[model samples]
Target: MTRFGFRYRARRRVLAAGVLAAAVLAAAGCGGASGSASSSDGTVVLRVPDPGNSGVLARGKKDGSLAKALSAVNTKVAWTGSTGPFAPAAQQINAGQLDFSQGSITSAIAALGQKPGFKLFAQIAPDKAGEGILVRKDSPISTVRDLIGRKVAVNKGGTAEYLLLKALEKEGVKPDQVKRVYLNPAETAPVFNSGQVDAWAVWAAYSVPEISKGKARFLVNGDQVGSQNYSIWAVRTRFAEEHPKVVQAFYEYLRERGLQQIKDPAAFINVFTEAGPQAFNGAARELTISNLRQGAAAAPIGAAQLADFDGVARFFADLKVTPAKVDVKPHVLSLAGSGA
Candidate 1:
């Protein structure tokens, strides 16, 4: 089918899917109201999910930064693997499988609309360098427009998809022209390496490893498109509302740790790279440092940030990634002392 024909058909199907999803979510109540309570042993464990690659928690845990902060509050921190798009992790958070989760702002927004129980409370890296559509070093796909009728891997509903869509928009490629293969960060590399996918739209840890190996080259990067990328930490609303102290202390810890990294980029990069994601070695080191240097220091998520999130939500809605416009403010956790 022609690109125009495919887009026309996909649009109709997407609209139907969006409506059905909305109706089902409405009936299902968008989850929440079931987050796990404090354990019987009187221990408060906060389960946090990461994108399985950023190594943010790893650095903190290794350096005892997290231990010091959580210990002071008598809270136990558990690191759980939450690779890929992170929509699953968000759903896990809604189902009470997780106390909190963090990832691409796109997934958080999508989850907010799909599942209502969670709240976005903190902003993490807005780093955009090294994030882009990567193609085999010798591949014929030389530019964004070269991807038409090609296969590109992206984690649907996550930052990968958002960047891919935005890139296509900028390049004037119809959405249906490129086939988007959905895969998690862990899964994407193998598939991309084996020539299973023509290209990959990914960021930071995911894209850096491959680029360092000289296995692929950027057809275009996130910065080339514009630096709108951001990751956020979110907790279950009930958790925030009920255990304000824990939430406040948690974000405070994150903000402090973030500042520490910014204050000493060289030391931070050395620690993060050597502590053995091991993928960040070789040529990847320079890229990693560049991204860290460009990364946003963790900070409170507030009005201007909320407005940016809301704008992204509208972008998703127009593209039918979400059922309709979502006013993101309702789901933002605004605790009194939380610095959220």
Candidate 2:
């Protein structure tokens, strides 16, 4: 099969099976409680996965800002921890297991590509600064080109997969030329540290802790591979269609509170400390904040973001990451000027 053809087929098979599994779960009543709120009822249960290592979510949880802001609209959020990523969350939401959850633009794209039933609610902060490829501290690999023929651990069908594909292409390394291991973050890190893999393309929230322990060295940041993208808040399209006002209010709270956090780096970092120990030290935190500010200054959901999404979709298409050439624009939700 051609490179794209092979990857696309693989993705389709896996995602198709995943959708079937979700369908069974839905029929079996194995999902979360249905989160339905009327304008008259005063609670909005915002179901989020356990913010395990998500400093942004953890920080918001710590200061009570995330809850307080939502409560302003007479909505209270309830977080639900699950092992599933965006696709399964979409399934759960469809199965009436969730109201809303945190997801990246790529996650939403992949999930929607599989089922097309979720609606992007709002563009959260562009966490572009968070994803990267890291090598062990003592590893001889110094550059992306050096990784050729080496074993690399990546979460296949994830943001890291796309990031690594772009990095490898930029370095003129063919996909099959390297040894790629498919692993989730939990599995990838321990094995990466134990020398089972030469490197890892991991999300920043996970990568930071490894770097802090001197377990790895960053080879390339995701921002260098693509335009600054977002971690979007999305819900089932059915839910959104029935409750436009609730959806609007939720978006408004996230945009307003997120912007406030972005404006004050020091305070943001302080709040993040509650998430965990320092992975990005003060210097790193400052750099991250600067990048977030740049993303915030751009239109919340601008043409630039759409362009980036297109570029990413094309990259995945060329790499044969999905079964079909997908259009990412329609899935994105732009809550412009509703930062109340």
Candidate 3:
């Protein structure tokens, strides 16, 4: 919060930039948003390529929601395409690999701690609906406290991990008291459903399918614990500075488009997965649609949201999830000059 601290963080980013430049050069043409490109027609092209699992932003092209918004400001787009989560995509952005990405606050804090030189552009969907820890519907682990000494599956270093930490704290339990089985999505359902892990702390995506089947029941959810995954949009800092107008267009687009998606997630899932129906199967997509309606709330980037960032940062620090405290305030941008 002090001037010196700000300078120190800035210096760290400068150093990280040098390292990122090397990574960019080494991994050229690998795929996804390619370093702020332009089209041959003398039009400026902004690359996003990936919209992560949700594809909420990427789907904007279908309705011309993003394209029209950007074109209104004289910008064209080049799709580098989407692959994985935000951390890697964010790395590509910092390394000049991509120009933008969206992710949960926990991952963004980790990215910030790494000094990726990306700025938080907007808060997209802050929802208290899906964060949950589940056990078999007939299981005896009926409450958060009941998980004491029992194994819970979580994707370590991701949102689910943070949920477990906060859930335990709210229930007056220490983290180590429960067994944590760390697994990615591919391995989670089998391990969890077979009773290899007594409970699974997860939100949306992989968790939704199982819960929708009526095989599992929630022991606790974000609404119950007063926590959430504040999903956000982030831009590579250099790109935003060089093309402020372009960034502003995306800001306006995300705000307007995100509201539309949250209001009708079923429609969003339809558009987002039309090309790749396998992206989310019938069960998962339906569950997501239900949760999005019940959970998603849209808000402008502001003090209250920033405070949530601080609280999550402290949670990361306490769990030693992040190496040290990351001052997230400096990187958040205001939409003043952006076309409202």
TM-score of each: 0.81, 0.76, 0.82
Ordering by TM-score:
3, 1, 2
Which of 2 and 3 is the better model by TM-score?
Answer: 3
- How many times do residue backbones clash in model 1? 0
CA error at residue 141 for candidate 1, angstroms? 2.4
All predictions: root-mean-square deviation over Cα? 9.3, 7.8, 8.0
Candidate 3 ranges beyond 4 A from true positions: 1-35, 51-55, 272-286, 337-340
**Runs with alpha carbons beyond 4 Å of true place in candidate 1:** 1-41, 50-56, 81-85, 266-279, 335-340
What's the lDDT for all of these models? 0.65, 0.59, 0.65
Q: Residue-wise lDDT of candidate 3 within 57-150, one digit each (tens)?
A: 5467666667778887778755554433456667768766667666677778888888677888777444456667788888998778998999
Candidate number with the higher lDDT (2 or 3): 3
Steric clash pairs (candidate 1): none
37-134 per-residue lDDT for model 1 (tens digits): 44456656677643222344555766787767777767776654433335666666666556676666887777777756788777754555657789
State the displacement of the C-alpha of residue 2, model 3, in Å, after optimal TM-score superposition: 34
